[model samples]
Target: MEKSVAPDNNNLAHSYNHIGGVYMNIREYSKALSSHEKALKFYEKNLPPNHPDLTTCYNNIGSVFYSMGQYSKARSSYEKALEILETANPSNHNDLATCYNNIGAMYYHTGNYSEALLFYEKALKMIEKFLPPNHNNLAHSYNNIGGVYMNMREYSKALLFHEKALNIYENTLPANHPDLATCYNNIGSMCYSMGEYSKALSFCEKALEIREKTLPPNHPSSASPVVPQNTNKNNTYLLAASWTIAVTVAALVFMPKFRELNCTSAYEGGMKAVIWTDVLQALVMLVGLLSAIIQGLIVLGGFGPTFSIASKGGRIQFDNISIDPRVRHTVWSLLIGSTFNGLSIYGFNQTQIQRYMCVRTTRGAAQALFINAVGSAFIILSSCLIGIIIYAYYADCDPYTAKFISAIDQIFPYFVMEVFSNIPGLPGVFLACIFSGSLSTISSGLNSLAAVIIEDVYKGLMRGQLSDERQGFISKIFSIILGAVVMLLTYVVSHLEPILNAATSLFGALQGPIMGVFFLGFFFPRANHRGCLVGFVSGVALPLWMLVGSQITKNQRKSERLPLFTTNCALPINETITFSSPVRSDPLLDLYSVSYLWYSPIAVSTVLLVGLIVSYLTRPLKPHAVDPKLIIPIDDVFCCYLPKSVRHWLRCGVDHENYLNERVCTEFIE
Candidate 1:
């Protein structure tokens, strides 16, 4: 029997459409439309009109329309794509997920937030089975969900979803890589919004530093434009932003220069000194920022601490290795679970991945990771001191803190705001830091996000290969659009109050479901897609519901604390409420609660067992979908490759504990 030949046109169209999608991401709808139309024409020539690739074209076109804010056209395009895809791929094919995802994105753009979520859920169901636990595409869905929550004033949910994406970024990508920067910026922005200015400053500065090192001199990546290229759209905009940042820095720096130009005032004197001093800081910062992306390493000292130390109520100190999974930072959980988390953060995130991919050996990558851990420790320690500084400053406490301006999270921003508000030149220094953080994140995300869409989602699914030049072109287009979106969102971010809590909860909530799905897939080979879908759905829904309930409970608690003078009373704050006692051991006690520490492992366990059962029951995908190596028992040969931390566990007769699939490792790496 002659072998059935796969159509080559599918490959060509797929490449074009995929690249086109990247352009659409940057808000270059016209370019995207052209690419999709070409893809559609090829689909018509090579395959039937009802072929799934055709649906992609329609879907993309509609997405462009939606991006352009043409709701009617966008909906029509989605409907056409849906009709075609359903006919060609049906419920089971992976193509359906993208189609569904496209619809969800449109609904979101059109302000049909609830409807957008509906389609996102549908698309996610399909992907939970096929993609890796650390897949970036899956992260996008999580991000989309988070964005919805953000729109709904569910700051917690928004942060959760964004963090879900960031968690994957942390595991899979490098610290200085552009994508990782996005995660950092995102997390930082949330912290900033939540009034954790110190944390926000730290995170943002880190992100900005990374971007400065990674992107070409003129790239515009600090924003999220749907169709932005990884590179600059025009040298004009890139030059403009650079000049603006430079002028801002100089203007702030030259407050003293102006005085030498003979500028006046105590403020001007302070500003000039501040500007010159700040200029020195910016130049020094350039070294850290520039070196970061190229080297996959960054070393940031604390933003010098003041004498103030704010009291943090909820904190965790060392504890015994208890059997209880709920225990915070048990010896086993931190050692075991954190290793997995670390692996994912390094192995899968684009930031981390892109960094090491350029290196000569795994040893180099490992060294970078070591540096990262060390750097992280320093940052945390410095933050603790900074927190103390805050405690000292606010110990007496001022009741009238503005959520937008002077919240705890706004420390970094507040500091910057203060520079301009009181001392003149200081604003220039902080502004550089802000740009360093935001731009780096936007640039990194734009680059990595584009790579994934083009490579994994497109190349993995489509049959053809792209030339390197074409790949470069595609990546360039995506970078711009993704950057613009980030910028737009930044503008929108000011609107979100109660930012830190929302960001944290949002991230934590996403972690459970996403981590669960992947854990189920990677650790359990027997799990079919049907089980995957069920587990994934459950993972998302359970966390979402839990998050909602938690929010409601919080609101209820607030309502109970109403002041004495309300005629038609709204909810009240519960002044009667008291949290756990302070830990004075180190006299510096602040960490995530125990419940959150175990959330990842708990969610993973839930998804795996639940997915296993679901797979056993549903049997969605063929056995081929579950790589045999993952399900089968492993041997001593694998021990050589294992990280030293886990090597002993395998020897101690616990190889059964989430065995790594050798095949899985190669799939993620270059």
Candidate 2:
């Protein structure tokens, strides 16, 4: 250091390169370009034309150009960088692999997927030879190749590469490292696209767990490997299933008129027709449920023996209050979680909301809501009664143990078929009911999805005005596409868990966040749209993480089930029955063991908390500026505190004033 050294342009160029890198990472693209250009000039002036410093400079410039979406310029710069790297290290080098990867990215962004895959493979091959097996950069190359394959719809190949990347990351990175999180996220997304929801959810949760532990509160990284939008298809699917059931029942029971009635168009006539049809369906469904309940009671010899047998079978779980999240059922989880789930489904779901809007008056809407609640309660009660009675019927015989049924899920269907075999037309009616319900759900899902796309996405993006008829036509096309896609996906739904449990689990995971968003919009006037979005996203993400982790842990700790037996049970001569032995469950982490029933409540609470906190940090919307109709009044919630006379008087005055205000706002806004 004491010796007088010549002014080293190499060091100056290296400093400039470092500066350019920092600028690029901070997203100051112009400054990054300037710094990189200066570095390139210094290298060109003072160093050899083929110097590595000049190569680095060109690559940096290309990255900056890519960030700015100057694709052609970026490609040219990348080519220049690659040329230098190839000349310097022709056989194998890490820089060469990086250059190839960057070029692949260029093709990928331009929608030339084939070319992108070709370059990505080239990069992978070079990296495999030059880098160590557990190198982070090696993982990056594998990930890139996997991503291209995923885009190409080659799921198996994509999974193989992604797993390779994951293995490398697991070996080299810390348990909670961010890169590992990203790897989990990528695999999760790929699995989701392939319709492997359970696996997708597991991986996504793993990523979320790692991020939560490693990243700071409010850090973008805290939500890394965010669940992809494609995973949301399940929600739509579930909604469709429900709607299809209702519609199918209506069409089958009502026949030709129901078939002719259409609700696709959001017009007065169509809306009215759909509402009347819904009411008819509801009444029919209620009647059917009541008949089933009466029949079940008669078969089970009244409530006493049915309750006793169900209790003996350990099927009644009302008293469970274990805080362990891994527990399958608990009082707190069921009551709190199911409450939120029900509320969200009935209150915030588009299907339910649309039905309410079709009513002529708010009072009519309220009446419809009341009818819905009553119907739902009756359905739940009927289901419980049926389950108890079925258990009683099988308690002595044990159908599964007797080899009459293969699985628990088949027991109910077997019972139905057997019980109604001699009853004229009853079995057919039940089958018809199920068919109608499913069809209605599919139709409704397609219609709702199309409507959302046309109104919110397509129309908003387009500048040219479209006629109502033209828009309707486009929506119809979208509906066809959605239905076709969903039908094709049905094939992948094989080997799933019980339908009711699967549906409920998916709904709980989805509905909580959605309900939270609605709550914020109605209850918290000060919450801005940005805050709502953050809250909604985090709300959805956290529950998914919890649910997936809980399920995975439960699977790992799954106890082997012993064969069921009874005094009258029959078995094949070759089969030997072994009774179940109690196995102590391993302790799980707190968040990993929560009950599935608690998913919705946890999600709603998380959204509210996160939304409120984030809103306070950002600029909040003014309370008075928000739509008055959207706000929930404190008086309504605390109405019990007021005397009946006072409540009635306040309602008379307030209700009329609100009506006048709403009418004025409607006119002014329209």
Q: For each candidate, what is the lDDT?
A: 0.54, 0.68
Structural similarity to truth (TM-score) of each candidate: 0.42, 0.53
Q: What's the distance in Å from true for residue 160, model 1?
A: 47
Model 2 scores a C-alpha lDDT of: 0.68
Every candidate's CA RMSD: 29.4, 23.6
Task: Write down the TM-score for model 1.
Answer: 0.42
lDDT of 1 by residue, 220-338 (tens): 23211111112323545877898799879877886556667422321222223333343444454454333222221111112232221121211223466686543534678766655
By TM-score, the best candidate is 2
lDDT by residue for model 2 over 1-670, one digit each (tens)? 1135344547777777899999877666789889888778878888876777778788788777765545456667777878987887676477777777766765654456798788878877887787778887778877877877877899888889889989988888889876778788778877887888888989988987887776553333342243443366667788689879988987677655544565323222233444554555555556555665666666666788779867756677677678766576667677777888889877888777777776789999999788778877877888788877777776555676544555567766666665554476675566655554555555555666777788789988997899988886787688678878988877754444556765676687798888888877766667788888899999989877766665555444433232233333321111121211233454554666566677788788888888988887898876546666666644466675987677545342334346558889999999
